[model samples]
Target: MLIFYYSKGSSALAAHILLEEAGANYEARHVALAQQEHMDPGYLAVNPKGRIPALETRDGFLSENPAILTYIAQTHPEAGMLPDTPYEAARVHAFNAYLSSTVHVAFAHFQKGARWTDDQAAIETMRAKVPVNLAEAAKLIEDHYFKGPWVMGDRYTIADPYLFLLHRWMEKAGTEFAPFEKLAAHVAAMRERSAVLRALEAHEIS
Candidate 1:
Protein backbone atom coordinates (compact mmCIF):
# COMPACT_ATOMS: atom_id res chain seq x y z
CA MET A 1 0.00 0.00 0.00
CA LEU A 2 1.09 3.54 -0.71
CA ILE A 3 1.62 5.76 2.33
CA PHE A 4 0.66 9.40 1.92
CA TYR A 5 1.77 12.03 4.42
CA TYR A 6 -0.31 15.18 4.42
CA SER A 7 -1.65 18.10 6.41
CA LYS A 8 -5.41 18.29 6.84
CA GLY A 9 -6.12 20.47 3.79
CA SER A 10 -2.93 21.58 2.22
CA SER A 11 -1.58 20.85 -1.25
CA ALA A 12 -1.73 17.23 -0.20
CA LEU A 13 -5.50 17.30 -0.48
CA ALA A 14 -5.27 17.23 -4.27
CA ALA A 15 -3.20 14.07 -4.38
CA HIS A 16 -5.38 12.55 -1.68
CA ILE A 17 -8.45 13.16 -3.80
CA LEU A 18 -6.82 11.68 -6.89
CA LEU A 19 -5.78 8.59 -4.98
CA GLU A 20 -9.39 8.01 -4.00
CA GLU A 21 -10.56 8.75 -7.53
CA ALA A 22 -8.12 6.13 -8.79
CA GLY A 23 -9.41 3.66 -6.21
CA ALA A 24 -5.88 3.01 -4.98
CA ASN A 25 -5.23 1.23 -1.72
CA TYR A 26 -3.39 3.93 0.14
CA GLU A 27 -2.85 5.02 3.72
CA ALA A 28 -3.37 8.65 4.58
CA ARG A 29 -1.25 9.86 7.49
CA HIS A 30 -1.88 13.28 8.94
CA VAL A 31 1.10 15.44 9.87
CA ALA A 32 -0.21 17.87 12.44
CA LEU A 33 1.14 21.25 11.45
CA ALA A 34 -0.33 22.91 14.54
CA GLN A 35 2.02 20.86 16.70
CA GLN A 36 4.90 21.33 14.27
CA GLU A 37 4.94 17.58 13.87
CA HIS A 38 6.06 18.02 10.30
CA MET A 39 9.41 19.27 11.57
CA ASP A 40 9.86 16.29 13.84
CA PRO A 41 12.92 14.19 13.11
CA GLY A 42 10.93 11.16 12.00
CA TYR A 43 8.82 13.14 9.56
CA LEU A 44 11.89 15.01 8.34
CA ALA A 45 13.41 11.65 7.54
CA VAL A 46 10.44 11.04 5.30
CA ASN A 47 10.86 14.43 3.63
CA PRO A 48 13.89 16.56 4.34
CA LYS A 49 11.93 19.62 3.32
CA GLY A 50 9.50 18.92 6.13
CA ARG A 51 6.57 19.44 3.85
CA ILE A 52 3.21 17.76 3.78
CA PRO A 53 1.89 15.43 1.04
CA ALA A 54 4.91 13.16 0.89
CA LEU A 55 4.12 9.79 -0.66
CA GLU A 56 6.14 6.69 0.22
CA THR A 57 6.51 4.19 -2.56
CA ARG A 58 8.31 0.86 -2.45
CA ASP A 59 11.52 2.46 -3.59
CA GLY A 60 11.37 5.70 -1.61
CA PHE A 61 9.31 8.74 -0.66
CA LEU A 62 8.26 11.40 -3.15
CA SER A 63 7.79 15.08 -2.20
CA GLU A 64 6.25 17.96 -4.09
CA ASN A 65 2.72 17.95 -5.51
CA PRO A 66 3.87 18.18 -9.13
CA ALA A 67 5.95 15.02 -8.81
CA ILE A 68 3.40 13.15 -6.68
CA LEU A 69 0.54 14.16 -8.92
CA THR A 70 2.35 13.16 -12.07
CA TYR A 71 3.25 9.82 -10.55
CA ILE A 72 -0.41 9.19 -9.71
CA ALA A 73 -1.49 10.26 -13.20
CA GLN A 74 0.98 8.04 -15.02
CA THR A 75 0.41 5.13 -12.69
CA HIS A 76 -3.31 5.12 -13.42
CA PRO A 77 -3.91 6.31 -16.94
CA GLU A 78 -7.28 4.59 -17.15
CA ALA A 79 -8.57 6.92 -14.44
CA GLY A 80 -8.25 9.78 -16.90
CA MET A 81 -6.26 11.80 -14.41
CA LEU A 82 -4.48 13.48 -17.26
CA PRO A 83 -5.43 15.06 -20.54
CA ASP A 84 -5.59 13.18 -23.84
CA THR A 85 -3.13 14.88 -26.21
CA PRO A 86 0.46 15.96 -25.75
CA TYR A 87 -0.35 19.65 -26.02
CA GLU A 88 -3.21 19.33 -23.59
CA ALA A 89 -0.93 17.33 -21.35
CA ALA A 90 1.52 20.19 -21.41
CA ARG A 91 -1.32 22.57 -20.62
CA VAL A 92 -2.23 20.47 -17.62
CA HIS A 93 1.32 20.73 -16.36
CA ALA A 94 1.27 24.43 -17.04
CA PHE A 95 -1.92 24.84 -15.06
CA ASN A 96 -0.55 22.93 -12.11
CA ALA A 97 2.72 24.83 -12.30
CA TYR A 98 0.92 28.15 -12.16
CA LEU A 99 -1.19 27.06 -9.22
CA SER A 100 1.83 25.84 -7.28
CA SER A 101 4.39 28.48 -8.15
CA THR A 102 2.16 31.51 -8.55
CA VAL A 103 -1.14 31.01 -6.80
CA HIS A 104 0.41 29.18 -3.85
CA VAL A 105 3.04 31.85 -3.47
CA ALA A 106 0.37 34.51 -3.28
CA PHE A 107 -1.34 32.61 -0.49
CA ALA A 108 1.89 31.99 1.34
CA HIS A 109 2.55 35.68 1.28
CA PHE A 110 -0.79 36.26 2.88
CA GLN A 111 -0.26 33.75 5.65
CA LYS A 112 3.51 33.31 5.99
CA GLY A 113 4.92 36.62 4.93
CA ALA A 114 7.78 36.14 7.35
CA ARG A 115 9.17 33.51 5.01
CA TRP A 116 9.95 36.31 2.61
CA THR A 117 10.73 39.15 4.97
CA ASP A 118 11.53 39.79 8.60
CA ASP A 119 10.61 43.46 8.69
CA GLN A 120 7.23 43.67 10.42
CA ALA A 121 6.07 46.48 8.15
CA ALA A 122 7.10 44.63 5.01
CA ILE A 123 5.36 41.45 6.19
CA GLU A 124 2.19 43.40 6.86
CA THR A 125 2.38 44.91 3.41
CA MET A 126 2.69 41.50 1.89
CA ARG A 127 -0.23 40.23 3.91
CA ALA A 128 -2.31 43.26 2.98
CA LYS A 129 -1.65 42.72 -0.72
CA VAL A 130 -2.98 39.18 -0.75
CA PRO A 131 -6.54 40.03 -1.67
CA VAL A 132 -5.67 42.08 -4.74
CA ASN A 133 -2.91 39.77 -5.86
CA LEU A 134 -5.03 36.67 -5.31
CA ALA A 135 -7.94 38.32 -7.08
CA GLU A 136 -5.73 39.02 -10.06
CA ALA A 137 -4.57 35.44 -10.09
CA ALA A 138 -8.18 34.33 -9.94
CA LYS A 139 -8.96 36.62 -12.86
CA LEU A 140 -6.17 35.08 -14.87
CA ILE A 141 -7.50 31.64 -14.12
CA GLU A 142 -11.07 32.68 -14.85
CA ASP A 143 -10.43 34.50 -18.13
CA HIS A 144 -7.80 32.20 -19.53
CA TYR A 145 -7.59 28.76 -17.94
CA PHE A 146 -11.01 27.51 -16.89
CA LYS A 147 -13.19 26.41 -19.83
CA GLY A 148 -16.41 25.38 -18.16
CA PRO A 149 -16.65 22.10 -16.12
CA TRP A 150 -12.87 21.68 -15.58
CA VAL A 151 -9.53 23.43 -15.67
CA MET A 152 -8.87 21.78 -19.03
CA GLY A 153 -12.44 22.20 -20.19
CA ASP A 154 -15.16 19.48 -20.21
CA ARG A 155 -12.82 16.78 -18.88
CA TYR A 156 -11.90 16.24 -15.25
CA THR A 157 -8.13 16.04 -15.04
CA ILE A 158 -5.66 16.16 -12.18
CA ALA A 159 -5.80 19.93 -12.41
CA ASP A 160 -9.36 19.95 -11.06
CA PRO A 161 -8.37 18.76 -7.62
CA TYR A 162 -5.30 20.94 -7.82
CA LEU A 163 -7.40 24.01 -8.55
CA PHE A 164 -9.81 22.92 -5.88
CA LEU A 165 -7.04 23.20 -3.35
CA LEU A 166 -6.35 26.77 -4.42
CA HIS A 167 -9.99 27.81 -4.36
CA ARG A 168 -10.51 26.41 -0.90
CA TRP A 169 -7.58 28.38 0.43
CA MET A 170 -8.72 31.45 -1.41
CA GLU A 171 -12.15 31.23 0.16
CA LYS A 172 -10.66 30.57 3.56
CA ALA A 173 -8.62 33.72 3.13
CA GLY A 174 -11.83 35.73 2.60
CA THR A 175 -11.46 36.13 -1.14
CA GLU A 176 -15.19 35.59 -1.75
CA PHE A 177 -14.46 33.16 -4.59
CA ALA A 178 -18.06 33.31 -5.69
CA PRO A 179 -17.49 36.50 -7.67
CA PHE A 180 -15.62 34.45 -10.19
CA GLU A 181 -18.74 32.74 -11.43
CA LYS A 182 -16.98 30.12 -13.50
CA LEU A 183 -14.46 29.35 -10.80
CA ALA A 184 -17.25 29.22 -8.25
CA ALA A 185 -19.03 26.76 -10.54
CA HIS A 186 -15.86 24.77 -11.02
CA VAL A 187 -15.28 24.58 -7.26
CA ALA A 188 -18.90 23.66 -6.68
CA ALA A 189 -18.75 20.91 -9.29
CA MET A 190 -15.51 19.56 -7.84
CA ARG A 191 -16.99 19.57 -4.33
CA GLU A 192 -19.81 17.36 -5.58
CA ARG A 193 -17.48 14.49 -6.50
CA SER A 194 -17.52 11.40 -4.31
CA ALA A 195 -13.76 11.28 -4.53
CA VAL A 196 -13.47 14.79 -3.11
CA LEU A 197 -16.03 14.00 -0.40
CA ARG A 198 -14.18 10.86 0.57
CA ALA A 199 -10.83 12.60 0.55
CA LEU A 200 -12.18 15.41 2.74
CA GLU A 201 -13.48 12.88 5.25
CA ALA A 202 -10.24 10.91 5.20
CA HIS A 203 -8.16 14.03 5.52
CA GLU A 204 -10.62 15.34 8.12
CA ILE A 205 -10.21 18.85 6.85
CA SER A 206 -11.95 21.61 8.79
Candidate 2:
Protein backbone atom coordinates (compact mmCIF):
# COMPACT_ATOMS: atom_id res chain seq x y z
CA MET A 1 0.00 0.00 0.00
CA LEU A 2 1.18 3.48 -0.85
CA ILE A 3 -0.16 6.33 1.28
CA PHE A 4 0.13 9.76 -0.28
CA TYR A 5 -0.16 12.18 2.60
CA TYR A 6 0.87 15.54 3.95
CA SER A 7 3.00 15.35 7.06
CA LYS A 8 1.63 18.56 8.51
CA GLY A 9 -2.04 17.75 7.96
CA SER A 10 -4.35 16.10 10.48
CA SER A 11 -6.08 13.75 8.03
CA ALA A 12 -2.78 12.28 6.99
CA LEU A 13 -1.76 11.91 10.62
CA ALA A 14 -4.92 9.98 11.39
CA ALA A 15 -4.22 7.58 8.54
CA HIS A 16 -0.62 7.21 9.67
CA ILE A 17 -1.65 6.27 13.20
CA LEU A 18 -4.18 3.76 11.96
CA LEU A 19 -1.63 2.16 9.70
CA GLU A 20 0.74 1.77 12.62
CA GLU A 21 -1.92 0.38 14.94
CA ALA A 22 -3.00 -2.11 12.31
CA GLY A 23 0.61 -3.23 11.85
CA ALA A 24 0.09 -3.01 8.14
CA ASN A 25 2.86 -2.93 5.59
CA TYR A 26 2.78 0.33 3.72
CA GLU A 27 4.94 3.07 2.21
CA ALA A 28 4.52 6.75 2.93
CA ARG A 29 4.94 9.45 0.31
CA HIS A 30 4.70 13.00 1.49
CA VAL A 31 2.72 15.48 -0.59
CA ALA A 32 3.92 18.91 0.46
CA LEU A 33 0.82 21.03 0.90
CA ALA A 34 3.04 24.04 1.54
CA GLN A 35 4.24 23.76 -2.06
CA GLN A 36 0.85 22.87 -3.56
CA GLU A 37 2.16 19.41 -4.35
CA HIS A 38 -1.27 17.96 -3.79
CA MET A 39 -2.45 19.86 -6.88
CA ASP A 40 0.41 18.74 -9.08
CA PRO A 41 -0.67 17.00 -12.29
CA GLY A 42 1.09 13.80 -11.24
CA TYR A 43 -0.60 13.66 -7.86
CA LEU A 44 -3.96 14.75 -9.27
CA ALA A 45 -3.87 11.79 -11.60
CA VAL A 46 -3.83 9.49 -8.54
CA ASN A 47 -6.51 11.49 -6.74
CA PRO A 48 -8.67 13.75 -8.83
CA LYS A 49 -9.61 15.78 -5.77
CA GLY A 50 -5.94 16.51 -5.14
CA ARG A 51 -6.38 15.66 -1.52
CA ILE A 52 -3.94 14.25 1.00
CA PRO A 53 -4.37 10.91 2.78
CA ALA A 54 -5.06 9.13 -0.48
CA LEU A 55 -4.24 5.42 -0.20
CA GLU A 56 -3.21 3.29 -3.17
CA THR A 57 -4.23 -0.21 -2.21
CA ARG A 58 -4.08 -3.41 -4.18
CA ASP A 59 -7.76 -2.99 -4.93
CA GLY A 60 -7.52 0.63 -6.06
CA PHE A 61 -6.91 4.17 -4.88
CA LEU A 62 -8.98 5.20 -1.87
CA SER A 63 -9.43 8.70 -0.50
CA GLU A 64 -10.85 10.17 2.71
CA ASN A 65 -9.27 9.45 6.08
CA PRO A 66 -12.29 7.69 7.60
CA ALA A 67 -12.66 5.31 4.66
CA ILE A 68 -8.96 4.55 4.72
CA LEU A 69 -9.02 3.81 8.43
CA THR A 70 -12.07 1.61 8.10
CA TYR A 71 -10.47 -0.32 5.29
CA ILE A 72 -7.36 -0.92 7.35
CA ALA A 73 -9.31 -2.07 10.39
CA GLN A 74 -11.54 -4.35 8.35
CA THR A 75 -8.67 -5.84 6.45
CA HIS A 76 -6.64 -6.44 9.58
CA PRO A 77 -9.13 -7.66 12.11
CA GLU A 78 -6.32 -9.22 14.07
CA ALA A 79 -5.27 -5.70 14.94
CA GLY A 80 -8.58 -5.27 16.78
CA MET A 81 -8.87 -1.67 15.74
CA LEU A 82 -12.61 -1.93 15.03
CA PRO A 83 -15.49 -2.89 17.23
CA ASP A 84 -16.92 -6.39 16.88
CA THR A 85 -20.50 -5.64 17.89
CA PRO A 86 -22.81 -3.92 15.44
CA TYR A 87 -23.88 -1.16 17.81
CA GLU A 88 -20.30 -0.53 18.90
CA ALA A 89 -19.29 -0.31 15.28
CA ALA A 90 -22.07 2.19 14.68
CA ARG A 91 -20.86 4.37 17.53
CA VAL A 92 -17.34 4.37 16.14
CA HIS A 93 -18.72 5.33 12.76
CA ALA A 94 -20.65 8.15 14.37
CA PHE A 95 -17.48 9.55 15.92
CA ASN A 96 -15.79 9.47 12.54
CA ALA A 97 -18.78 11.28 11.04
CA TYR A 98 -18.56 14.02 13.65
CA LEU A 99 -14.85 14.47 13.09
CA SER A 100 -15.09 14.50 9.31
CA SER A 101 -18.28 16.49 8.93
CA THR A 102 -18.10 18.95 11.79
CA VAL A 103 -14.56 19.28 13.08
CA HIS A 104 -12.65 18.82 9.84
CA VAL A 105 -14.96 20.98 7.71
CA ALA A 106 -14.90 23.81 10.22
CA PHE A 107 -11.10 23.77 10.13
CA ALA A 108 -11.17 23.83 6.33
CA HIS A 109 -13.01 27.12 6.39
CA PHE A 110 -9.83 28.70 7.72
CA GLN A 111 -7.64 27.05 5.13
CA LYS A 112 -6.28 29.12 2.28
CA GLY A 113 -8.90 29.89 -0.40
CA ALA A 114 -11.53 27.83 1.36
CA ARG A 115 -13.80 30.82 1.54
CA TRP A 116 -13.86 34.29 -0.01
CA THR A 117 -10.19 35.13 -0.29
CA ASP A 118 -9.41 34.23 3.32
CA ASP A 119 -10.87 37.53 4.45
CA GLN A 120 -10.47 38.54 8.08
CA ALA A 121 -14.20 38.09 8.58
CA ALA A 122 -14.19 34.61 7.09
CA ILE A 123 -11.10 33.56 9.02
CA GLU A 124 -12.44 34.87 12.30
CA THR A 125 -15.79 33.22 11.62
CA MET A 126 -14.11 29.87 11.24
CA ARG A 127 -11.92 30.44 14.28
CA ALA A 128 -14.96 31.21 16.40
CA LYS A 129 -17.09 28.34 15.14
CA VAL A 130 -14.35 25.74 15.41
CA PRO A 131 -13.94 26.02 19.17
CA VAL A 132 -17.66 25.77 19.76
CA ASN A 133 -17.95 22.73 17.54
CA LEU A 134 -14.87 21.12 19.05
CA ALA A 135 -16.17 21.59 22.59
CA GLU A 136 -19.46 19.99 21.61
CA ALA A 137 -17.64 17.08 20.00
CA ALA A 138 -15.49 16.62 23.09
CA LYS A 139 -18.56 16.56 25.30
CA LEU A 140 -20.26 13.97 23.15
CA ILE A 141 -17.20 11.77 23.21
CA GLU A 142 -16.92 12.03 26.97
CA ASP A 143 -20.51 10.99 27.54
CA HIS A 144 -22.05 7.72 26.41
CA TYR A 145 -19.80 7.47 23.34
CA PHE A 146 -16.69 5.47 23.94
CA LYS A 147 -16.45 2.94 26.72
CA GLY A 148 -13.04 2.70 28.40
CA PRO A 149 -9.55 3.93 27.61
CA TRP A 150 -10.32 4.53 23.97
CA VAL A 151 -13.28 4.86 21.70
CA MET A 152 -15.36 1.64 21.62
CA GLY A 153 -14.61 0.88 25.26
CA ASP A 154 -11.70 -1.21 26.58
CA ARG A 155 -10.60 -2.10 23.11
CA TYR A 156 -8.77 0.51 21.10
CA THR A 157 -10.45 1.24 17.81
CA ILE A 158 -9.69 3.34 14.75
CA ALA A 159 -11.70 6.16 16.29
CA ASP A 160 -9.02 6.85 18.89
CA PRO A 161 -6.40 7.71 16.30
CA TYR A 162 -8.76 10.06 14.48
CA LEU A 163 -9.71 11.78 17.72
CA PHE A 164 -6.09 12.14 18.73
CA LEU A 165 -5.30 13.70 15.38
CA LEU A 166 -8.14 16.20 15.68
CA HIS A 167 -7.34 17.06 19.28
CA ARG A 168 -3.78 17.92 18.32
CA TRP A 169 -5.12 20.28 15.67
CA MET A 170 -7.51 21.85 18.12
CA GLU A 171 -4.66 22.49 20.50
CA LYS A 172 -2.68 24.16 17.73
CA ALA A 173 -5.69 26.41 17.09
CA GLY A 174 -5.64 27.48 20.77
CA THR A 175 -8.80 25.63 21.61
CA GLU A 176 -8.90 24.73 25.30
CA PHE A 177 -9.86 21.11 24.98
CA ALA A 178 -9.46 20.90 28.75
CA PRO A 179 -13.18 21.68 28.94
CA PHE A 180 -13.65 17.99 28.20
CA GLU A 181 -11.48 16.38 30.83
CA LYS A 182 -12.18 12.80 29.87
CA LEU A 183 -11.51 13.44 26.24
CA ALA A 184 -8.27 15.19 27.06
CA ALA A 185 -7.21 12.33 29.27
CA HIS A 186 -8.17 9.93 26.54
CA VAL A 187 -5.85 11.68 24.13
CA ALA A 188 -3.03 11.59 26.61
CA ALA A 189 -3.56 7.92 27.15
CA MET A 190 -3.51 7.28 23.41
CA ARG A 191 -0.28 9.20 23.12
CA GLU A 192 1.27 6.86 25.61
CA ARG A 193 0.43 3.83 23.54
CA SER A 194 3.51 2.23 22.01
CA ALA A 195 1.95 1.96 18.61
CA VAL A 196 0.88 5.59 18.65
CA LEU A 197 4.27 6.67 19.89
CA ARG A 198 5.95 4.65 17.21
CA ALA A 199 3.77 6.19 14.57
CA LEU A 200 4.52 9.71 15.76
CA GLU A 201 8.21 9.03 15.94
CA ALA A 202 8.19 7.46 12.49
CA HIS A 203 6.57 10.58 11.12
CA GLU A 204 8.88 12.81 13.22
CA ILE A 205 5.79 14.67 14.38
CA SER A 206 6.05 14.61 18.13
Give the best candidate by TM-score: 1
Error of 2 at 142 (Å): 1.9
Please state the error at residue 195 of candidate 1 in Å: 0.5
Per-residue lDDT of candidate 1, residues 1-206 (tens digit): 89999888677889999999898878888899989999999999999998888999877999989889888888888898888799999999999999888998899887889888899999998888888888899999999989888888778888888888867777766786878999888878978999999989877764
RMSD to the hidden true structure, all candidates: 1.2, 2.1
Model 2 agreement with the true structure over 69-138: per-residue lDDT tens digits: 8998998999988878898888888889888887777666545435545478766776667666766666
**Model 1, stretches more than 4 Å misplaced?**
none
Judge candidate 1 at residue 147 and give its lDDT.
86
Off by over 4 Å in 2: 2-4, 116-120
